[model samples]
Target: MVLIGSHAYGKLPDLPAVAQNLTGLAGALRHPSVWGLPDSHCTVLDQPESAQQALDALHAQAPLATDTLIVYYAGHGLVDPYTDELYLALPASEQGRPDTALRYEYVRRAVLDPAVTARRKVVVLDSCYSGRALIGEMGAGDHVTAQALIDGTCLLTSTAETRKALSFPGERYTAFTGELIGILVGGIPEGPELLDMDTIYREAHARLAAKGRPQPQQRNRNAGGLIVLARNRAHPHSQAVGAPSDPTLTRLAPRTVPLLRRVSRRSLLVGAAVGTAGLGGAGLGIRQLLLAGEKDAGGGVGSAPSHRTTSPPAAAPSASASSSPTPTTPPTTQTSSPGGGAPRKALKPGEVAWRKKIPATDDASDVLLVDDVLVLNLDGTLHGYDRASGERRWTLRHDAPFARRLSGAAVGSGVLCIEDENMFLQGVDIRRGTKRWGFRLATEVDALDAMPPCVRGGIVYAARTGASLYALDLATGKKRWSYSPTGGVGANPTVNDTVVCVGVLDPTGNDVCAVDLRSGREKWREEFGLIEYLAVDNQCVYTCAMGTLTGLDLATREERWSQPGVRRDPTTDLQPLTLAGGVLYTTTVDGLLTARDPWTGTVRWRFNVRYGERFATWGQWSSGGGATPIIDGQTVYLGSLAYLALPDEAAFREKNRATHFVHAVDAATGTERWHFEAGGATGTTAVDATTVYVASSDGYLYGLAR
Candidate 1:
């Protein structure tokens, strides 16, 4: 473990709390209940004179540890004005002179060196714009964030890429580090005996949010959370009377520790009820099992305060529902209701239904409807709420370390399917918040990644990137059949009753592969430049690649129509194509909303959705936000990323701030009706008969009504 802190600077204001941050964190790390590393093992680099000096100490100490390597930095982080690269300030470092300071790239290169053979690596950055390290080369002052996660490592940052790290006037240490150390020494009550990186980060994030501080961000890969950092001293066994030696107080081991399975009270009760005859007496058996599980699991079924719900008020006529002539209904399969039943009433222009505050960081985490329950995944936990009242119904936690934007989710057969942190496809009961089954998707790096899983009938189709596609039973999670194309399935599959169409990533370029839905037999394969989005119906399969949209016949396997200059980003645009009401809705090359004919790529109309801009900057109003439009009745709802221009000095210090807004537009003429402003950037959304649920980056889930 190497702890570095720089508290002095030449031009910029000094950060005095960095010194205490190092001292406090070191003490917590050496505690008997924590890591308990010896004095000789822990290295302290206080106020290193040069970047090379810090790199030398880090490289020297990193290679000796065979178990885990922990490197933490607490200092003023500087960003280059020209390149937007990050730097760590030293004692003699100036604000704008990055050459005189320590380049974070040098430190990253050292920690990622091949000579460092530590079993696990963890890096903690408690500085401004530290989150930039999570990505590859960044854009020149763009407020948009991207992910290029490092494999086999865990990274925790103090703030977002465009935000500043906070420290109050008289605090002992920095905000993020202080909260982290408190959790390490104090131990999380009702938590597991072993504290992993995921658990620690979740607790600290919640604590800092409650205190109105900037929330932190984390990224993990290759099971980095399995590397246990500290032992929980607050477990009941640690204070038990006349008990055996408490394992929670033991010293750290050199190998990874398996996470204990958390058995909820509901599961234990069901288990007892199923085998009451074999358990001798129902009363005594139930009591004992409940006691055992409740000791560690604090919140579960029948916990009134934790899982509270309020009845939704009686429905009334929408005041803003102006009586317009009902338009002709199209003969399309897509409907707003999950059951494909009657369509719901569209939200009117400039109407507000309900607004809620929620912790929604992952843009890939979608809003799904399972009957009357609204399901959303925040961080690593799955949340179910009442769709009508916005009341939380239940929550189920995943043991994995980090949440990924590409970890897609789907809902069908009354079950919600999602890829967890361990790369396992888990089928969860959307209404009850219980796990039905889990299926392993990959076992090695060759089968490392997967696109979002799509469900049809009783079988769920999942594609492992560059690997084979598997059809699993939604109820049992057992593999029904597996299909491996020459090139693996690259994008999410679109399925109808008979066939499943997937975008294939070949060695040379990309292709579109179609397979039989039930038998997993290859039907046909064709070449496309690089698929960005895909959709399917009974007659044709639509694919967007290289800024072009093409329609392929289902039977002939020939191109039906081709149109160029279709704009999309596969990493962020989860649902770019919406086929409904006999019309296709998509974004154009210039980020304008356009209604097109699916059979013949002819645009009906285009509407400019970019409205507000705080500055007259380049590309500020060029493209619309990336969120896909949600269509119901006659209105299309879309969320966008808006910019906020700060004062001249503040804008120079930080490039710009980005906010979010949701707009309602007419589906017929492509005219924007109403738009509701949100506190942060928006993600995917789900709608009901009268309510539209939206997920935002400002830690809020909103429900807009007419």
Candidate 2:
């Protein structure tokens, strides 16, 4: 048996789901009736080249026909649009280039070719582009002799080439793998002894379609006799499709939410470290704090926003703290009620102006709003649409020539800076979406996928994933200077005129270090936890992994206030803080949309946005609170849906799992002004003056009038 996957990717964000898929299948195959937990014969490969080596060795060492070879692979599977070929990436493999990835032909020759002696062969693919393997190359019908057809050869693919395999938020395995494991453990209708290869594929396909997921399928090859895989270990009386997953076998980790937005340079989860230390060891009980107006540096005894320009941070309506609050008394949910002073003008999220649906695409980044254009990266192309009309404006196929993955543009300095996973940075004219300048990395240096570059003052401040930091001229893509640190580099730099703040780590502890933007000299380094995200405008660093949000002085690097464990319900933590229109917003695992004071960590208001009472049947679906909140001018929007994270992993991903909603709340007052009850709601949100755009996991991008 061969199990291969690449989870520790260097040039791209690591997919934790890969690890889940690997371990889940490995456990299922070891059932007593299957392989009987035979550790000696199984081979596991994590690297791309290593998998090829193992396959080549198999051909040289072809042995007996009794040997049944089983193959399982889960990773980033890319289909070259130019060549119409599919390639599977290894840990060190590059995205677009075929040389770095394992080609499908190699897999076909190693496993499907008659020259190899294995009589029984089965291949299972669980990936985005996995279905491509069963197309033209492996077409059915007459091919060669009847002797080859008699051999019990089978192939199972996760989804059609056009659809993407969905990931569970906190479950151990993906939707496809989880269902497959259940069937192998539980006996079929005819019992485990009489189960055939076709039954396995058909059962998995039914399970996927039932969950509103892309249907997995099998072709003409599943025509063998009964192939007993394992003894039925599930309860004899129970006949549920998913009743076989052993509770003991389900491995659980600290529940984590994967951020899908592209506003930051690197993914917030990967670019951070969840250390034991909390906010430099400052422990403050934030559970009972009431909503209070934001106080400036001197007013609240905390550091103020950097005074680089003459203008100060926007003033919010002052809200005084409430008297001793009991646990039962939640924060007030009044829309026009400003706590301490006169009511502020509540934002009116006007009715829908227009709603349109965009074509479903692959690996899409969050919808971006730049210069009145809504931009989203799909497959190998970047599409721009009119923010109001939803009309196609321009399509940027810059990466089409190389087929490399394009980083969403970081717009500033009249240019849009894009970083490719292959270590090439390009500057494009923002309005025209035309490439103006490009810079390629030297051979000796490696690019970091977790540390994205930030553009400020016509300069780009970026850190290499495994090396040092560099500042580049945005207009010309020229390196200004480089600073080599001792260890790995992190992303989301908070750049002010005086210094650029970066998160760095070494053997000791995680730290937030400051460097002089002009000189590239270290100004100060503070012992702090690895930062999940840094808000530069307010000099705030948040570690969502630890549930701590700390404010810092950009000039002095001193701690203003630290709010550790500031979540409404402790089931899951808040997403990294998002700042817009002078207000900070984040969602909680318990379905609370929270607005906080920028400097003092005071609660502005909290709104409960659960799916419904019917959803209460499943206690908590998903890491329910991980959906991100978007701030559009004076309004805050959230996509709220329930996902069954426990009990059953695939319960919530249904064609109709229950009704879902996208809410528009007044930023200042935490009151729902308007809402759109679109089912299968997600955090993929972007807004303009006229409309709001949202994407559902069910392959639909909806445009709603605001």
Candidate 3:
């Protein structure tokens, strides 16, 4: 990989500032990993004597067939308005412009010669009106002179002739260069067959759109036989042909209401009665009364039957002296009344397939279903439970005080990676849950908390609150590389094969960055002001900043599109968003659940729950709950406060405080399906197809079944 920039013009009076331009070029050059390669393999050439010299060096150090090559230039690029010939800037010796700086065709001739040994070549150009510099002209076939010079070369340039490229003061690189770096580092990795130039060009184009910059254009020349590998299969819903089908739709057996929703109403009432009678050993004492009602309904009696009388059953003993004694009810049963009546059975509370209590002193903070293992973060330890049985398998302990606050956990190569608020990175044996290694990053930075760590291949990437990024080995916890953005990193880093996408807060603005996972070099950078949350699927990266949501093409670091004015109240802070089944779910500070279209950014529906006293006070104490909303298929789950006052208001006033309720809403219509008072559920809820699990601050984990 090579980076070339020539901004150091000596006393050039008419041309734009070259030194400023070259500085930006150098920053990009030194960071080779940004181009999706290991830093050890890259070289930078700041000022070349001639196009021949630059080409000579590139070809002389030919890369192996297995290696990928990337070349980038950030300087003045001009084209002959008539012939549309491209040229790159060179240092001028005098105050006047030099006609012999460097022709685009000559640069192409030097670099594209088939004599070069590299298998794949990517060229990025950032210049004024750089779009016209691409190899092919408008409406022309792929075989331009530039394309004919090299085999398997891809070219990306700034803007078309009609659109102006953006440059900012104190920016080491222009928007184009920044966006290119963002994509190169973070773009998804494709297989050898898909590693072609045209794909890179398309990825870059998308990144620019997200940055609110003029869309970059590409001209494909000699790409007929080239194969551009895709990092992930295209989304089945994408406009692109041959999109991959969603496995969730294909693999799972169709839902059949699970035999519970089919029960009749009369059966439910009988089951409830039987359960009560069994506890009291009343021996079907209420059967006669129930049968009499049926006879009247059949018109067998002139007037309603006299009410039956029965003695109340004795109360059962209490488990504790501080609480009143309660009856121990027998499980309900299906039974028939007299006169050969139809049988009835009440719906039973769903069975508990399995349950396990956390250590008495600890509580679970999060649970992740990774393959067959259920990983739980409880107190300050990580535990793995069998998903099918909820049986504890193993446990790994970390020394960080705030380990319970860890948000993200990913598994790779049989190693589990986790990040804690203390900026501690922990890696554990996935099967045994034994601590393999751990590292404390930014020991001197007090505010530096590491976001959740994501693992790809054998490497783990994490972002820190202080604007730092770290790549570590999955097995050894060794630091591979680190990068600091102009702003601090707050979002969890996401890793595809080649790039690591991170959200950062910088002096210019809050932005998302794509860094080369191998070299810690920035591949692309796109700025947004006050970014809040980020999530990525197979095809696009979704981010929320201010009140708006934006989607960018993951491969190009370009914004494919955006949704502005999302109508969120300024006072309501948004929590991390979750996307599943083509829907995006998020929560506002005031406890409203909002769902929107992931592609179009249109709100599907919003559900609001009335807050009770405890929730209102908790919001006042903690700013607002940062719990992310949960989604399972077509249902959205959220926790809210519901207050109920005692009838004797003066007496036991303190005991009648408000309670928290977990509400399950239908995703399609935003209507509440069921509301259960859970009492002080301060954290997020988790769900499988049949059950919803939530934790309460009152020291319990409640499981409710559908």
Candidate 4:
């Protein structure tokens, strides 16, 4: 298997951050499974080149009889407003508008042409406004003939046109790429039975959507013919391939410490039955039963006599205790508290591993792990940490600081890229944590209120706060190209091999655009007045607009299918998307999180967090505020604020004060796991294998052990 990326990070004036993200992407692709085809048969091309050169090389390569070829991109995309044509952004010094960027038609003709290869081709895009670029009609940016390609092409994009893509502070790639790497690196299961391309695309889209960005879209033309070779699978003969040779696999191993088992099977069954009966209705009873299974085993109703009394008092007696004489001293005589004596501290400093303080800022937005480094965005400064020891490595501060609010980061090659509230792009060195270059919009604009910048190849793609989009180089901080809309650019851009896609907001509503990465030319544009977010797969681009979600063809930008009744508001900042275990997860402003079918957008399960109590006060014109949902395997995390007045009348009048609470839920089924109260939490949450990390307005970073 081979993966190739053609990314343009706009221009390089002084930003090394773009370069860092690109470098990190290169490193991710360097994994053995991605390019180690039996005997190292894969090649990567991230160098600067003209659209013609890139297409020519792709066309020249001989078709493979049996194998897979994966092509990826991270840059700018364009779309033609009149004809809905798509294009890819490229490095063109002469052309500065959207009319001259690389077109998708050209890419199709040169690289995806059916005659060029018999092997399956997989294309992944991490650019702004990528959905529009994939399937729309060829336009001025369409520099190549349309009748030049064959079939068996697979396509994937980061977001739809209406939503923005993000780059967190420490991420080596955009959220899309980070998730992709996570999937490829075993964060997601790999196998023919685990998930197909369509499923993966849908999951990826949902995951992104939950975070307030559009989901990645996909298109698979060959149905079952498109084969996704796992990127992290090792050779069968490798030493790590077989079952564990250690005794721990079959028996206890040496030096192993034993953990106490807290709950018994009888206790669990009894607790579940009682909890179920207490919930009242059948649906709630079922929900409670499920919740019972998820609760801390030792903390269930069966373990507490007082909890059972709080209900109708018809609860059954403990099953275990009924069979034996009750001890005079109760269960406390049999077992001690898990903590022994004192209440355990929420988080110990030693458990912190490492900590670094932001000079003058109190808030940070995103964090990511690239190779052995941890990157953090603290207010306006970008900090790097040694992943192993959590030691401070370096820091990069913005010379012309925009907003104190930091957004996201993307690391490539050796550069670290980040964005601010004003949509300013900054690039830094990963090793030294020093600023390499930076760029400001010729016109002051904000891409989307909370969206982050994305980097690919050596280009950085960012959406201004108003309505303009830009692509810049990582090394020199030069402006490669820019795109402005009659409406504002609301969505972040997603880049594939030869195209970029973004969402635009006008007085009438929302639309998606496909742009060329190299020349800043547009290929096609599609309008959906109600759409808010987008996701891509190999065969189609999925979008959520108005109150519905739909899929569009990648090659022709035509609507393939539509799923209705999926509505979200503008103030609902996060994308609310996640993909895992062949499922797409999304959250809405109404406090509902859903797991849906990626192909059809049908609801699989819906989880509600609303508790019928107003939690907090809202600014003028705002209904309510909530954080985006986060998913880790079978667990989902959510945070929100609600208000409650001292008097019922005052509360009903919306005059009550509110408090915030953080919740953890099960991803497979909509069930609450645990909840912790806090002042407020913004942005997304991060997780390691053993703990969950969250930041709040209370001036404390919380570490919740799993």
Give the Å error, residue 261, model 4.
38
Positional deviation of residue 693's Cα in model 3 after best superposition, in angstroms: 3.2
* Residue-by-residue lDDT tens digits, candidate 2, 174-251: 667666665654434423222334445545554454344566644322222122333333313222233444443333
Better of 1 and 3 by TM-score: 1
lDDT of 4 by residue, 1-706 (tens): 2233333334511112234334444443343323222323333445446666555545544243233445555655555443334455555412245555566656555545555434445556665556543332111111010001224445666764333355443334456665554443332321222233443453354334333344565544332112333322222322223423322111110111122133242321100000000001122221133223322211101011110000000111111112111112101101111222322343321133223333322332434434334555555566676643445688766655534322234444445555544445667776677777777653443334644455544566666545577877755667888898776676656554466767787667777787887777878888766555655444556666655667778788787777664434444433423433334556554455676656566676666654334234533111222344544433556654222112335434342212234566654445666665433333345553334454443344444443
Each candidate structure's TM-score, on Cα atoms with residue i matched to residue i, is 0.47, 0.45, 0.45, 0.47
Query: What tens-digit string does per-residue lDDT give for candidate 3 at 1-706?
Result: 4545565555432223233333333332232211112344445566676656665555554433233344555565544432334556555533123354566555555455565444445455666555545322210000111122233445555765334455443333455654443332223222111223333444444444323355554432222112232221122211221323323212211111223335453332100000000001122211122222222211010111111111111111111111211222212222222122333333222322223555433232544443345566656667676644456788766566435533345554455566565667777776677788877766656545556566554566766676578877766888889988765685667654357777887775577878886799998887776766676644567887777778888777677777753324565556555654345666654556776766556777777654322224323211122345555423456653211222324443332222245676654567776665533433455554334555444444454543
Q: What is the C-alpha lDDT of each candidate?
A: 0.57, 0.49, 0.46, 0.44
Ten consecutive residues with minimal summed lDDT in candidate 2? 271-280
Writing each residue's lDDT as its tens digit, candidate 1 over 18-69 gives 7777777776666544545557666677877787787778878777756566
True-vs-predicted CA distance for residue 191, candidate 1, Å: 55
User: What are the per-model C-alpha RMSD values against the true structure?
Assistant: 23.9, 29.3, 28.8, 18.7
lDDT at 135 for candidate 3?
A: 27
List the pairs of residues colliding in candidate 1. Answer: 353-705, 358-699, 358-700
- Residue 643 shift from truth in candidate 1, angstroms: 14
The residue-level lDDT of candidate 2 at 157 comes to 65
Off by over 4 Å in 1: 1-349, 360-365, 401-407, 446-449, 568-575, 588-591, 611-624, 641-659
